[model samples]
Target chain A: MKRHQNLLMALAVVVLVALPLWMVHKPAPGPDGKEAEIFAGADSQAEGLIGRIDPGYRPWVKPLMEPPSGEIETLLFALQAALGAGFIGYWYGSASTRARLQREQETTTSC
Target chain B: MHIMEGFLPAKHCIAWGIASAPFVAYGLRTVTKRVREYPEQRMLIGVAAAFTFVLSALKMPSVTGSCSHPTGTGLGAILFGPAAMAPIGAVVLLFQAILLAHGGLTTLGANIFSMAIVGPFAAAAIYRLVRAARLPFGVAVFLAATLGDLLTYVTTSVQLALAFPDPVGGFWASFTKFATVFAVTQVPLAISEGFLTVIVCNALARLNPRELQEMRVATGSEQEVQA
Candidate 1:
């Protein structure tokens, strides 16, 4: 039963990922053949809408640091996440190990 | 939804910030109380925040030939409840805005309101309701995570609609347009997130029943054995 569930989940993931990729990459009927970017991050899409709504509107704020390139931006984001995950994983592992050891020592002393 | 830098009018941004302030305060209080009661939970909260950060950073292809990321609040909401997740989510959003340039400081309040407060609360509510219904753990997790993700997008759509109502059809029409666009990407992402959370939850339950128990996830039989 467990194996069946896992297989189903794996299949679901493949389909979910593949369907989108295929849709995105498929040739479009437009003259340009380039598909329009229908899905934008909420921020950009919202900004675009705001621009359309009121052309004279100026942005009140700016990003603190913009990465030199998109790749660099992605790299920095990934780095931060990795560092955070590493710290968290280490902390959890050590705490759990210490707790187990303390429990074992208590049982031995009691015996 | 991350309202871009200068996307929302100044008033909208300030309003969202004010709206989220109380929730953030409450969440900090919850975290402090938990940490005081159990020093180990300090690390757990940090781990939860990191987990949210890492998972949300994963970009996936969407139906519209664009990339979207998961919100990743479901697992944390399941572990720590919604109130506790608010502060953790705030940290993640702040990092994304500053480091990734994904969101802006001015829009941070709106982003936090949608992704942090609303998303986690929705996830927690759904998880609790489904679990109370005595459904399978996997099903509950899947529903909570998927719906939580969808709800984030929905909230974002509403925010956008409110800010820029369509000239022709007004707020409702504008909202529909935004929601439709978001749905194309978000629906698949939500399903993927649901499966991922369930897999992660199951793995945690098997490998670290103690952690699951500490987080108060009902590991059922496995937890019983460990106890």
Candidate 2:
């Protein structure tokens, strides 16, 4: 069970790191007052040993060169939505905490 | 409110992971002691199994159509006490993951911590407080139900914020979005849950006060320990 959790965590790390890096170089400066994000082409080649075997290789996974909405604010919030999810996790741990607190209260009350 | 995939920042997930470790440990310890102290371990396990089946199987659609199931902790908390419910909820979540695939096994701790540990406490607290205020049983039940659902979302939002914190938007905005997702759908669902919980509580109250007392002893306030 623990190993499965580790594997999931590892997969999450790999995807999170590689995907964003594979897609965008940086947020571009917009003509207006905003900053724009530029897209990376799937055709761009990797230089490492793995790529040496197949120099002309393309990535199996490809995301749109463009951001989902092209809005940094929305994209940022979407990220937040994922990260903030543990609030529910904390709630899941609460019932036992309740019983513990109540037990403490009972002791104090009796005293 | 399973927190959705790719919703939160990595940091939030890690922090929640840290926060959950102790709860899991403590819940296991307490549950072990309870089973050892009591003679009806099998019966208790059966009750938990049956109760949990209802909790996950009785799903109704929420805003996202992601299929929200009842935490069902209100009655469980009132019946058992919050401590005992942690393992039950965790087990139920485990079962749901295997049987229903409603939530992820990777996120099992997070799910158990929220739905089981948190839901019952919020419900039980509200129940105790409302009853102490001399409110009607129905009102007490409704308030507990509402708070349980609200707290569940709040916990979920916090988890999201921790998993995916952004320096620009900060935690508040993140909290707002997550909370809103729940608020839109859960507000109505909770109202109905409150009505149902009230009905159930009232029915059980009438049907068998002794069972309620036993459950309360199993799950509830610290006073039971001293008694």
Candidate 3:
């Protein structure tokens, strides 16, 4: 039961990620007369509402350093994920090794 | 819940910065104290920060037909207390602001307030409440994380609404519009975060029982540590 629960949890996460992409209805065309982009980031969508609400408002400050292009932005985001994944990998590896060695030590002492 | 770099006016940005400063300061002190007192748990702390880093970078599709990412702060808030997540979250938001330009420097305070401070506090509170109610361990973590994610977006909606109230209907109407945009898109992603946090916590309980104990996360039945 415990094992199945774990599997079910994993399955739920997978379903959450895939469900929208799999079952979404296409939104109406955007202002540019092209079909609205699917799965666009909500942040930009909020920015759009800001524009509609107050057309005169303009962003006063710009990013000190932005990725030069979309690809670079993706690359940086990928880099962030990579850095994080690396730490998590190190954590699991060390923790597992520590647990295994401790278990072995306990058995040896008991014997 | 990134409000973009310059989307918030100068006054609003400063206001949020002021509002968030105290929390971040206290949190930074907590992080330092943790490191100083329990050197063994440094790696676990790193893992917590990394979890947020990875989770926030991934823009998952939501049932609302938009994409949004989870703050991944709930687990840390649950494990280390809400205060510690503030500094960790600040670091991650700063990274995104400067490098990815996903969130901007101007709006960093508001973003940090919403994603880091408010979300973590809410998560930790809910975690305590649910645990006090004697819910299952998994249920507590799941609720803490899912609600934390949702509340972060709700805070963002509130911030945006405050800054740009509708000419016709004022703050409430603007809040409704912004909440519809952000919070709705966050629902599925929040659920995914809840499950992911539970999976991670279960693994930690199994493999690093001592660490969890030291962190005080393995209480009672939650202490299903490898025997």
> All models: lDDT?
0.79, 0.52, 0.91
The most accurate candidate by TM-score is: 3
Q: Tell me the lDDT of model 2 at B129.
A: 85
TM-score of every candidate: 0.86, 0.56, 0.96
- CA-only RMSD, every prediction: 3.5, 18.1, 1.7
lDDT of 1 by residue, B8-124 (tens): 788899999999989999999988988888775665577667768776787777776666778888888888889988888888889888887777888888889988988899999
Model 3, residue pairs in steric clash: B5-B104
Q: What share of the true interface contacts does candidate 2 keep?
A: 0.00
Q: Model 3, range B1-227, lDDT digits (tens) per residue? A: 99998999999999999999999999999999999999988888898999999999999998888889999999999989999999999999999998887889889999999999999999999999999998887899999999999999999999999999999999999999999999999988999999989988877877767877888775454434544
TM-score of 1: 0.86
Worst 10 residues of 2 chain B by lDDT: B217-226
Q: lDDT order of candidates, best first?
A: 3, 1, 2
Cα lDDT, model 2, residue B51: 43
lDDT (10s digit) by residue, model 2, range B5-85: 222234444555576667667767877776676544434344443444444444344433223445556655655556667
DockQ of 3: 0.84
Tell how far residue A36 is off in model 3, in angstroms: 2.3
DockQ-derived CAPRI band for the predicted complex in model 1 = acceptable
Mark the regions of model 3 whose C-alpha exceeds 4 Å error after superposition: A28-33, B222-227
User: Is 1 or 2 the stronger prediction by DockQ?
Assistant: 1
- Summing lDDT over every window of 10 consecutive residues in candidate 1 chain B, give the lowest-scoring window: B218-227
TM-scores of chain A across candidates: 0.66, 0.29, 0.87
